[model samples]
Target: MLCPCRGKLKLLVVSLSFVILFTWLYLLVGNSENGRSLLLSACLVESTEARLLERDVLASRVREVEEENRQIRLQLSQSQGLAAQPVEGNYGNQQWVASADTGPEDAENTAEERANHSECSRSPTAEKCELIHVACVCAGHNASRDVVTLVKSILFHRRNPLHFHFITDTVANQILSTLFQSWMVPSVQVSFYDADELKSEVSWIPNKHYSGIYGLMKLTLTKALPSNLSKVIVLDTDITFATDIAELWAIFRKFTGNQKQVIGLVENQSDWYLGNLWKNHKPWPALGRGFNTGVILLYLERLRRIGWEQMWRLTAERELMSMLSTSLADQDIFNAFIKQNPVLVHQLPCFWNVQLSDHTRSEQCYTEVSDLKVIHWNSPKKLRVKNKHVEFFRNLYLTFLEYDGNLLRRELFGCPSQASSESTVLQHALEELDEDDQCYDFRRERIMVHRVHLYFLQYEYTPTDDGTDITLVAQLSMDRLQMLEAICKHWEGPISLALYMSDAEAQQFLRYAQASEVLKNRKNVGYHIVYKEGQFYPVNLVRNVALRNVNTPYVFLTDVDFLPMYGLYDYLRKSIVQLDMASTKKALVVPAFETLRYRLSFPKSKAELLSMLDMGTLYTFRYHVWTKGHAPTNYAKWRTATTPYKVEWEADFEPYVVVRRDCPEYDHRFVGFGWNKVSHIMELDAQEYDFIVLPNAFMIHMPHAPSFDISKFRSSPSYRYCLTTLKDEFHQDLSRKYGSAALKYLTAQRNI
Candidate 1:
C-alpha cells in the first residue's frame, strides 16, 4: 500500500490509500504476493487508478477466488498437459519477455494494465515442496570446464537433484543419462524444447555452446512447470552455492511488501569490467542491464498469466538479445528490466550471485566467508580471473552471513534457514538437441583472397655449396623470425606476434611494438610470446608486455612463419592506394598468404641428414621437422615443406601484414609435421576469425627441402615412432575441433 508516487507528489497519499485497498482485495482474491504488488501499482493504471481501486476491488475479489479454484484443478493435472498446454496463439502457458519503455530515471517505466494476459491463480494443497529451475546451457560436457565438480557438489550438498532442472540441448544426454543411471531421485521431469514447435521463434537469447534453436525450448521449460508452483528459481549449470537460498528468498519476500521479489547480483557499469565484449554492434540503449542473470526467482504463474513469454518473442524479433556479446543478450535484457521496471526489480547485494571477475579477477576468493549463497566457475583459462572473485564472496558468506553450516548445513538440504534433504534442480537438457543439416548457431563466412607480390630474397644459395638450395630453403622456409619484420614493415597498426619466448629481449620488443607513437603515427605492434614454459612467468607478464607496446585500440597477431602474399591487402582494392578504415563491427581487411621461397633438403640417410654442417646457419631450425614422419620419400618431402610459423589450411589465419621481432615460436605439440599450427589458430578462439578464403589472398609456398636430409629421413626408427605418435594426437585434436569438417576433409577425400 506504500506506493511512493515519485512523479507527482500530489497523489502520494491518495495512491497509497488505493494501494492499501487493492492489497486487501488481492489478498481476499488469493492473488499471489507478486500479483497483489503489481495489481496495486499505479504505473499500470492508464485512466483512473483511483476509480478502478474504488469499484474493482471487491468485485474482482470474487472473480479472482473463482479463477483461483479453477486454476488449482488445472495445476493438479499439469503433467497431463491440461493446465500447461496453451490453446491457440500459444500452445503452452509460456512466460513472455516484456519490453517496457524508458520512462522516469530508468527506475520507473510506463506500465499499462496488460489486456491480453490470461488470468489464473492457484490454491495450496497438502503437498508442498521447493522447486528450482536450471538451464543446462551446453551438452558437450559443459564448455565452461568446471561442469563435473560443480554438478557433483550440488548433488552432494542438496539431496534433491531430481528437483533440479536441465534446460539444454540433446547432446547433454551424455551427462543427463549418466545422472539418471546414477541416481534414483524422484520428481525429475524433463521438457525437451523444440524451437521449431513454437509459433513465435526468433531467439531473444543466444545459446553459444547449445543449439541455436533453443528459444522455444525456454518456453517449453516454462510451460512444463506445474501450475501450482508459487515460485521458480532459475539457475545456470556453472553456479555453486554455500547459503541456504530460502533465507535469501525470505529476505526478498520481506522487502517486497505485496509481491515476490526477484533477487540477483549487479554487474559493473564500467565497460572494462563487463562481459568479454566492450559494447554492442548495433546502437541502442544497452539491452540487458546490471543484473547477473545467472540466478533469479520469479512468480511462475504470475509471469505466465501476463503472457511474458509471448512478449519475449516479440521483443527478440525486433531487438537484439544476445547475452554472450559483451553481455548483450541475456544479461542486457535483465538489465533493461531492472532499469525500466524498478517496481518489479528487487536489488540484492553483490555477494550471493558471483560471476567471473574482470579487471579484479585476480583478487581474493570467498568474500569474507560471511553470507555466501552461490558460486559460478566460468572457464578454466578464465578461472584465474573468475575463481578468486567467487572466493571473495564465499569468504564473506562463511564469516558474516551468520550461517552455522556445522549445524545448518548438517541438515541435509538445510543450510542456514531452509529445510533439510538438500535441494538441487533436476537437469534434463540432454533430451533436447537440434541436429539440422545447416548450422544456425554459427555464421560461416566466404572470403576472396588473392595472391599478392613475391620476389626472391636478396640472400640466396645453390645446392652445390651446401649453400645448397635444399638446405638453404629448409632453413629460410621454416624460420618464422622474418614474419615480425614483414608485419612491422607493412602494417601501420597494432600487430601482435606469438613468439616462443618472453625474456628480457622479448620485453624490449613489446615496449617498442606498443609505444603510442609506434602504434599510432607509425606501425602499431603488440607482440605476445608463445612461451615453451609459460608457467615460469605470470600472465600479467604477457599483459604488461602488450600494454607497454601497442597503444592502438585494436591489435592483430601475425605468426613469424607467414609472409604477406605480395599486395595481399590490395586484391579487392579499387586502387593501388586507398584510405584505411578501422572498426570492430567488421573485419577491416583479410590477409592473403604465401610461403617465402627456401632451399630444400634431399638427404637419403639419417647419418647424412644429421651429418650435414651449418646447424647454426642454413639448417637453422636443426632437426625440428625431421622429428615427425621420419619416412624416406615423405619425410624428406615433408621436411622440405615444414616452416615454424606454418598454417595448416586457409582457415588458420587472421587478416594481417608483415612484422619481425626476435621470437622463437616452435611449439612441440604444434611441431614436427603440420600439427602445431592448428594449436596456435585454435588458441586465438575468436568465433568470427573462422577462415573465409578471400579470392585475392593466395600464398606461393616456397617448397621445403627436397634432397638435403635424405639419410636422416630413413633408418630413424625412434624418430618415426615420435612422428606417428604426434600424428595420432594431432588427428584426435583436429577431429575434436572441426568435427564434421575433419570427417569431410581428413579421410573422405583420400586423393586430394
Candidate 2:
C-alpha cells in the first residue's frame, strides 16, 4: 500500500504541477468573449433579484392604497350615522348653547391622540377641549348648500369643541371656506380637503355614475383623515340635527369594549331591502334590514385595526364589481362585507336616520317624528320636491345661510349688529346685495327675470273657436305682469286676467295692454283691471273676483305664476268635451312643478318639464299636504307617469282647481299668505264631486325671488284689518252654513 501510495503521490504531484501550469496559462490568456459572458451571467442573476424586489415593493404599495380606499369608503358610508342619533348628555342643557364659543378658532386645545381623546374634554369649558373631527363629502352648488346647512345644524347644537373636515374639490373648498369663515364658532375649526390627495389610493375603485367619485373619498378616511384625529363623525348633506352632536361623539365610549364593532350607524328604517331586487343577494339580510349610511359614527383607532383591506381582496375574488347593482354602489359593497361580520357593526336606533321616504316605512320604524334627533330625508323626491319636510328643513337651512352671511358681514365689514330686528338684517343684506351688484356683476337673476318676461309677455295668444274649452282665470297686480304674459302666451284657449292693482299699476298695465301686440291682438282673452285703494290685497277676494269673471262653461282657477303643462289645453278640451257636463261634477287636480332655471321658451310638453327635473333644471314645489288625504289623491304617485287617474276628493288643497258647475263659489274670506283656500276644497269634497288628477295637464310655476318686503305685509295695519274682517267673515259663513262641522276645514294655523 505504501509503495502504491508513493507511486500515486509522484503521479499526482506531476499531474497537479501540470494542472497548475495549465490554469495559470488559461488565466493569463483566456478567450475575451468567455470572460465577458461569465461577468454578464453574474450581473443578470443579481439584477433579476433586484427587479423582483422592486416589483414586489410597488405591488405592495398598490395593495396598501387599495386597502386604504376600502377603509375610507366604509367609514364614509357609516359616518352619516354619527350625528343621526344622539343621547341626552351633559351638554344637552340650554346653558351649553348660551356658553358656546363664538370666535374664529379654538386656541386652548391640547387634546392628544385617539388614546387620550376622553382626556381632551376633561372640562365643560369649550375652548380647552379637543376638537372632534367631523368629515363630510360635498361637491357642487347643491351639495355645498347642503353641507353649509348641515354644518350649521351641527355647530348650532354642539357646544363641544369640533373641527369640520370638508372633503371637496378646489371650487367647493373655496366656497365652503368662505361660507364657514363667516361662522363665529371658536369651538369649531373648519379644514377643507381635496380628495385629489388620496385619489390615487382608490385608483382601482370604480367610477360609476350611481355613487359618483365623492362616495369613494370616505374609503380612504383611515389614512386621509389627520392622524391626530383618532375618531370622527360623518354626516350626509340631507341630515337635519335636532339634538346636541357632542352626545353623538360620546357614543364612541360604547364601542370601547368591543374589538369588532368599529362603526356605529342607524338601520335603514325604510323598506330598502324589502323588494325582490335584494332577494337573490345573499349578502343582504332579511327584509327591512340593513343600515342607512346617511349618518355614521366611526372610531378611527379601531377602524385602523380592522382588516378593511379584505374588502378589496374579496371584491376581486368574487367579481362583485360586475355583479353589484349600480343603484346601491358603494353602499352595496359595504353591506356585502359587513353582512358576514355583523359583529363589526353597532346597531343604532331607527330615529337616528328617520327615513322620510315612504310614509308607511317611516311610520313602521321611526314612529315619533317629533322625538327624532336627526331627520334624514332619504327619498330621491327630496332632490326635486320641496314638500312639507323639505320646506321646513329648507327654511331652517336657509336660516343658517342667513346667519352665516350676517356674521360674515359683521366680522368682515364691521357692519351693524344683526340682533336688532328682521328689518335691520334685511337692510344690511340689502346693502351687501347692493355692493355685490357693483362688482363685475353677472346678473343671472336679472337675466332670468328678463327671459321669463320675454317668454311670457311676448308669446302671442291666438283665440280658438268653440268659445274656448276652459277659461284660464287668475288674480294679479302689475307686479305679476310677467306671469300674466306667460299665462296669456301659453294658454291655448280663452283667458281671464282679473287684476287687483293700484291706480298707478292699473295705468301702467293699461298702457302696456293697449300697446302690447300679444295682449292687444288676442280676441278671446278678457282683461278686468280693478284698481285697489288699500295696501292689503285680499287674495281670496281677488281670486273670487277672477273666478266670477270666468265666462266659459268650465273654469280653471290658478295663480299668475302658474302655466298649464304644454298641450294641456288640447288634452283638457278633448277630455272635458267627452264628460257629461250636466251630471259630471269632476274636479281636475293637476301636478305643479317649479321651474328651477330661467327658460327663454316655455316647456313644450310635460315630458320636457320632467326631463328638466331629471336634469336638475326644474324642481317640484311642496305638495306634501296633498299626500295626507288633504286632496283627492297624491299626484306624486304618478305625477310624471301615466295620465287620467281618478281619485276621490277627501279634503281641499290649494287654488289649483277646475270646475264646470255646482261647485261652491270662492269663499272670498281667507286672506294673507296661503290664505284659506283649503276651505273651498273642503266644500267641494263635501259635495261628493269626482276628483281626477290629469297627468298630462300639469302646471309649471316660474321661479321668482319675491322682494323681502313680502314679510312687511303681515305687520301692515291694512293687512291686520283685512285679517280681522276675513276672520269675522269666515266665522259668520261657517256659523251660517254647516256650523262647526266645517270649522276643522278652516285655516286653523292662522287662527282666522
Leading candidate by TM-score: 2
Please give the TM-score that candidate 2 achieves against the real structure: 0.38
Candidate 1: stretches off by over 4 Å: 1-136, 143-147, 159-162, 185-200, 204-221, 224-228, 248-252, 260-289, 317-327, 360-367, 378-380, 386-752
Give the CA lDDT, 0 to 100, for residue 49 in model 2.
Answer: 78
lDDT of 2 by residue, 1-752 (tens): 01122233344445545545655544543347766566666557677778568657856765665565565444432222221222211111101111145331111111111111222212123232435678887765457655655765776666556678888876467556643442333445678778778767655655453447676667667777776677888887888787767666766765654556777776565445555435564433421356677788877777777656565347433544555332454455555555665667765555566667653244444323454567776667763443445565555545554343222222212222223243344345445544443211211111110000001111224434664368787777766787755676677677776676543454467568768777767656655544343334556565665566455778787778877875677777776765554467788776666665667466687767667777866666544333332334464675455757676543335537777834687664454453356667766765656777766766777767663335654456654555555555555666567765655545443442
**Residue 111 shift from truth in candidate 2, angstroms:** 38
Candidate 2 residue spans exceeding 4 A from truth: 1-130, 207-209, 274-288, 310-326, 358-360, 383-752
Q: What's the C-alpha lDDT at position 236 in model 1?
A: 58
